[model samples]
Target: MIHQIRIDNFKSLVDFEIGLSRFSCLVGLNGAGKSTVLQALDFISQQMRGDIDSWLEQRQWEPRDLGSKLTAKQNVDISVQVETEKHGLIEWSASFNRQSLRCTTEEAFCDGVRLLKVEDAEFWIDRSVKQGSLRDVRSEIMFEYQGSILSQLKRKQIGEPLQALKEVLANIRSLDLLSPEHLRQRTRDSAGHLGLGGQKLSAYLHEQGSEVRQRLLEKLQHAYPQLASIDTRSLRSGWKHLDIAEQFSGKVLSTPARHVNDGLLRLLAVLSQLASDEHFLLFDEIENGINPELVEFLVDALVESEHQVMVTTHSPVILNYLEDEVAKQGVIYLYKNAKGATQSIRLFEIPSLAEKLQFMGPGEAFIDTQLTELATEIQSLSAKGGKDVSAAKR
Candidate 1:
């Protein structure tokens, strides 16, 4: 699990640091930098994959473009400090200039030595000009820009870094911003590979016997009573599909991935990801398109599951269900200041607030206490006249 993240010079995040919990919910209005935080994680993953250049290119800017705009330097530099449960602390930084595309200036520290450095080819340039009576150096270094660190290291028989990168990527999964078609394709694909987003859910089910399938169905039903039973099968020509039988109805309904509603598909996607051995799950707008009553069940499921889940939501129903868990410091609320910088406040840390009151759930207590109009009015009056003004006047 990542205990904390410190971001600097990243897009829309000048300097942001937020402590994370095992199961956290980032709540605020839109453009509050929620998606940007997720994007930072994605940026790290892409960098580890050795697709940093391509990633920047996809952003439609060169290092100089970003650096010139943000830092007023010829090169753009960004750093991410990640504190992990297993790795302790790992700091990764990348810098890019117009002359040099992108360079990995830093990586995981092991035994006082950096594990990796920017390959010369990554900063490939055509020619080097001299200022005075010196000869120009035109030689440059460049590596294959297509493959990730894993692919590059595998070719060189370097396995440790690849394994580490893979582990980190596995721990970070983003299901937000997924298109409808992407969701459907992932559902269909998960039936076979369940890699991520249920990419191979089908293959895993096929490998399991009837007993395993039955046990899984029982567990799913326990988590969601609306689900009667789930059946999966492969077509005669080898296409896999899922059939969901609704409770109280004997009729079995079958449909391809495209026909399922967004809520059900999102649930399945989340469940599939949670079923893995990965420790951390990051969910953006988790309450989107889901039934309100089911939100509690989802929260309860995540709490009971072995993995540590971090979800962002605006639903009061979900917040209410999580109040108890949050009182134990399991929940965090992310908000933006006047300048639009992200800040976090723990619900449990509210002064003069008892655990019992806090556990009454976020809907009636925290949200009402902090965001209600009455509370705001009280605060305004207190600020103007002080707390003793009412008693003294009376």
Candidate 2:
């Protein structure tokens, strides 16, 4: 699991680092850079899977503004430190110049010690040994950077440590709130792991066994009481159509999946993700189109999956449900500093959190912290003018 993450000179996340829990939530007002963090993580993962250029094109990010516009920095840095019960601790990081996104420096470490460092075109791998130790790996390998060294090593099985880091980085999955219409379509691509936008849900559902399918249907029923049944029909055209029944209809009437409520459709997409085998999950704008009443069920869905999950939300109802599942430390509050940089504070890390939680629910506590005064607006530095800006009263 990823124990922590550090992102520098990437969009709004300039020199940002945060500790992670098995389950965590990013709480912030609009434009607080929560999505920026998720994007940075996604960018790095995509770089490992493919290359920087392809990832940028896939995301449709304007290359001119991909790097931190807040500074003249020529490169961006993204890193994650992960620890497993068996493999211990490892850190993987990459630095690529913004202009060409060509690799500048890429490095990995084991237990806080550097294991490999890659510069412009040169690669270095350390195989250090303790004197007279039978487990000596003092030999090292050096290669010119054609692409990511970690990716190269994994493809070649050159080193166990590099392979571990490559595997972890390649496994990162970030699921943004899915598009309803996109979810309704017959998926053109069938991915074992769900895509960043939660497409191919139809294919995913059709591929699951009876037990998992029943569980997914039950989750849908919990969110949409009227949802009686869901099944996929393979047409003569060899395409799949997701069909559903209403609770009152008792399987007599079936509704095409496209007709499902927007909120219900999003919930279905989320449930599909929860049912997956991925070890780590990141979701952006998770509250979009979800029923406020079903917030608790959503919490249960995430918790029951037992994956290392992170989501960003502005919903207090969601927070109230999360309060019971995650400790105070599991909540990270993202706010904008005067410099317009993103800043974070764990709710539990605050000494006075108990006093606030005692008087009100977690949702209310979050609102209380965000308030300057009843009449005054939440403030931030204006990125355009570098002046103080006010947000309307919550």
Candidate 3:
């Protein structure tokens, strides 16, 4: 799971860092750079998959658009710390050159040992370490890779630590752009995971095993008690379609995906992604179309799930539903410093906020307090040119 992230020269985020829990929620006023937090994670995932140029295309951004506008820096840097079952803790950082649209530098370390390092067109990897000494076995690659040299390395050539890091980065999934129109469309692709917008949800369901599908249906029934069963079938055009069987007055009524309500379809999409094999999930504006009661249910489900989940919300109801313990550590507040760069701190760390939480719901406390005032208090408490200790609290 991802433990922490630090980003520099990336849009509104300049020297920004935030720690994450198993289930976290980002809350802040508009333009506080909440969505950019999710985008940073997606940016890292895109870098791992391919070159910077391709990622810019996905976001419809230009080469120069990658850097933070607040500064003249031409390179965007992102660092991630992840905890793996086999490798323990691994820290990886990469620098992307805006002009070249390629990774200028990349480095990774496991247990304080360098696993991979790249500078310019050359790269080095320490294949193994014994007795705290680097082994004589080292591999060198001299070439200019488009995106990440670490990602380009063959799995057979790298050891288990590097492999585990790659897997974690590859599994970082973002659903910040789920579209109802795409969810209603029928597609022929049977992707192992749901597409970013859930466009291939039908195809994805088609690929799930029987046991997995059964588990998904049971979970969905919790939100839609009338949903008797879910079925997917191959169409004549080779596309797959998803249909729902609803029990009505002792009879069954089948409804196609296109006819499903916005809230129900969105809920189904969320549930399906939760059941997927992805390690991390990011949701933006999680309360968009869902009812309050269903939003409560979604929150409960997210907390109960094992995956690392992060969501941004404007709904106070979402906060009110969270248990005190979860809110204490899982809620992160994003704000802007006097320099207009994004800054983050746990909501519980705000002075007197913890005391207020004891008397009021987290939602009420958030609504009553002014985030700007809180941000000012934090800025004064923290020293200049110092590490953000608030981010390290997690």
Best by the lDDT measure:
3
lDDT of each: 0.52, 0.67, 0.82
User: Estimated TM-score per prediction?
Assistant: 0.68, 0.83, 0.93
Q: Candidate 2 residues 51-125, lDDT tens each? A: 666666657776666677677787777777888665588877887666655556777777655667766456566
Sort every candidate by TM-score, greatest first.
3, 2, 1
Error of 1 at 89 (Å): 4.4
lDDT (Cα, tens digit) per residue for candidate 1, span 1-394: 5555555555555555666666767665566567666766655455445555665665565544433223434533455444445445544455533354434343433233344444444321111111221113222334444323333444233234324534665356555454445455523323222432344445455554456666666756755666666567776656556655665566655555567677776676566566655656767778876788678777877766777677777666776786465644654545544454554545444343344363465655655554323223434545776641111111
Residue clash pairs of candidate 2: 127-137, 127-138
Q: How much is 272 displaced in model 2, in angstroms?
A: 1.5
Off by over 4 Å in 2: 126-147, 209-211, 235-238, 247-251, 324-327, 351-354, 372-394
- The C-alpha RMSD of each candidate to the native structure, in angstroms, is 9.6, 5.8, 2.3
Better of 1 and 3 by lDDT: 3
Q: Which digits, one per residue and each the tens of the lDDT, describe model 3 over residues 263-342?
A: 88888888888887888999898888898888889999888888899999987888898998899889998888888998
Clashing residue pairs for model 3: none
